[model samples]
Target: MSSHAPPARTHLLIASLCLLGLLSTTGASLPYPILAPLFAGDVGNGLSAFLGLPPKLLLGIALMVNPLGLLIGSAVLGAVSDRLGRRRILLATAIGAAAGHALTAAALVAESYPLFLLARFVTGLLEGNGAIMRAMVVERVEGPLRNHALSWLNGAFHLGWLVGPLLAGFTVGVSITLPFTIAAGALLVGALLAASALERGTAAAKAGERWWRVARERHAFTLLRHAPLRTLFSVHFAYACGVAAFYEFFPLWLVDVGGYAVREIAFVNMGMCALMTGAALFAGRASSTEPRRRASIQAGLAALSILAVGFGSLGVGLAAIVLFGLPHAYYNATVQGWAADQFAGYGQGAVMGLLSTTFCLANIVMALAGGALALVDTRIVLVLGGALALWAALAMRNWSRRAVSVAAQAVELR
Candidate 1:
């Protein structure tokens, strides 16, 4: 008999994790649709204007706070899971995240800005369960099976992005916080699913060490001490910057250039996300090795640059928006698989965490950079995104040469 369990068991495990991804991300995204309206100086003045800051500025801070928390959490939580068992940490975080959402609901009801920010930060922190999920997929499912599992997981996440805002939009009319409470309940369901799928034993490494000591010493950021990882981080960060720019500003491009409104923009996003989800289902079958994956990423970045530039005009923009999802799906799944394979010695948890942290940092940096550029021209910001993508591709090509050189040197030494 093969050492692996039955294929059916693997399928069930993947299915459970996908459901977990879908549910947790649904909860994570629930607050997004509501945030714009809340801080636009209309529904909740007391919360928005607490420090007498401009509502727009307050909105920016509110948005930044969650991802900032997520950046820290993603770097820390995954490393924690490497020491602790996956299920226990994930389960605790899920329950804690539900409480965070509840706290957000309470803050909304109370109209307290400080409380609201606190709730959002904590919620984002717990939402770092994403790193845990990715690590679990990479660790449990081996060989080609890993790719299929991750594709479905990524697909489930994309579907959640589509599902969450719609759910929030529907419930916001009833009460501002109703969607958040619903989100909490959804997360609990996800926790149950994760519990069913995950293995129970803790890692034996540094077995008696303090949790904080482990987290402090072995988190994803610690990976940067190595020269190769620094190169990997640079390429990933640059590519992520391009992605973040497009993600943050493309809607603005539609608004400013194409004269689209909220509902129309939402429709475009719906189509894009739907395509992304579908593409993710097929991304694993793309016939990829590390070199091919790198080439595909470069190609995808170049294509994204073109799409970004062409996306300002209404007719082409609509097509560009929807078409972006296909390559995006392939890019995400493949990069993840590549990272897991390349850095398994670092611990899959920490590797996955580093990727999430990189993305979140890119989002933050791009949002700030794009916001400034948008003031000049939305089209200009979109073009900048494309330029960054091209730069990232160039960087990737250059890095591959150095990687080959290093390999040749190692062979000579041996």
Candidate 2:
């Protein structure tokens, strides 16, 4: 290896983490496709009687548990990485995720509901791979390249949601045990890669703020209080609620009401995701060209898309969902870039930790409410989701305008 090869190791490290992040996320997702089948099987049927609960309720319990794990994990683990160094935490969490998957596989084989929940919850808690990988990208890169990296990272997440089930389908014919086992194995490989591939860094050695204490930093909150960030967070958070509602309930609606098979729904979801991935590529280009313009176009598209969904057009629904998601992912990536610009002196790992915290809180609130709303009517779910998007579009318009005004003020002061 050349003298300059260490940094190249960093690159390899990040790439490995990104793929592992994708697999971890995708593996956690595999349960979604198998939920109904598991429910119908002898194991699930027996548990339903023993527990005196509907299978859907059990499935929802398991499905929702992971996101809750994720919301908490993203914050806690992201902060841990900030303090403990990304490498150690990344390795530990990847292993923990592997354990979670193994537990999940064992739970399936043993037909243990409590073990199943514990495994899924633990896996959810270890879901820090996404945030960590993104932070790693931010840590390892600078300037325009950083922006590109975040865009690509965001795309990987979208891609994971798309591919998770397709990969799971291969095992569906053999046995549910196979998919969970594969998931666990993927995570194990990820752990090994993370341990061997990443270079040693000293960020962990510098005694900085504790994970919770980081919230109290003036600069951290100042970044949050900044006019552009304030508006950006609001628009992003509100639109994200709608996005949350869709992801939470759409598949359930199709499978329960539309009478679609689990595999069919996964394919439909894959279609939407493929479209989203394509749109993200385009939106990233627009963001690079002019962020504010791109945000405006995204907001407008989101507004129009929500309106389409409200009209109950599945075609329109699919189209709108993709349009909204594609731009939103780009918008978040650009916001992360802007954050790097505004907080240039700050620790990226810590700053992203806070951002992830804020996002988790937002998702938690929306998901709980969204899940409750699903009990009423799927249309209510769609309407509320659309409404949030529409509101976000309006907020983005004002947000962009305010951002320009603030920049002008800074220039004048200078």
Query: Would you estimate the TM-scores of all the predictions?
Result: 0.92, 0.84
Kindly list the per-residue Cα lDDT of model 1 for residues 53-161, writing each as its tens digit: 8888888888888888888889988988888767677789888888999999999899899999999899888888788888888877777888878888999988998
Candidate 2 lDDT trough over 10 residues, lowest sum: 214-223
Count clashes in each candidate, considering only residues at least 3 apart in sequence or on different chains: 0, 0
Q: Which regions of candidate 2 fall more than 4 Å away from where they truly are?
A: 1-11, 40-46, 205-232, 252-263, 281-283, 286-293, 344-346, 357-363
TM value for model 1: 0.92
CA lDDT, every model vs. true structure: 0.80, 0.67
Clashing pairs in 1: none
Candidate 1 — which residues are off by over 4 angstroms?
Answer: 1-5, 41-44, 204-208, 286-307, 310-312, 401-414
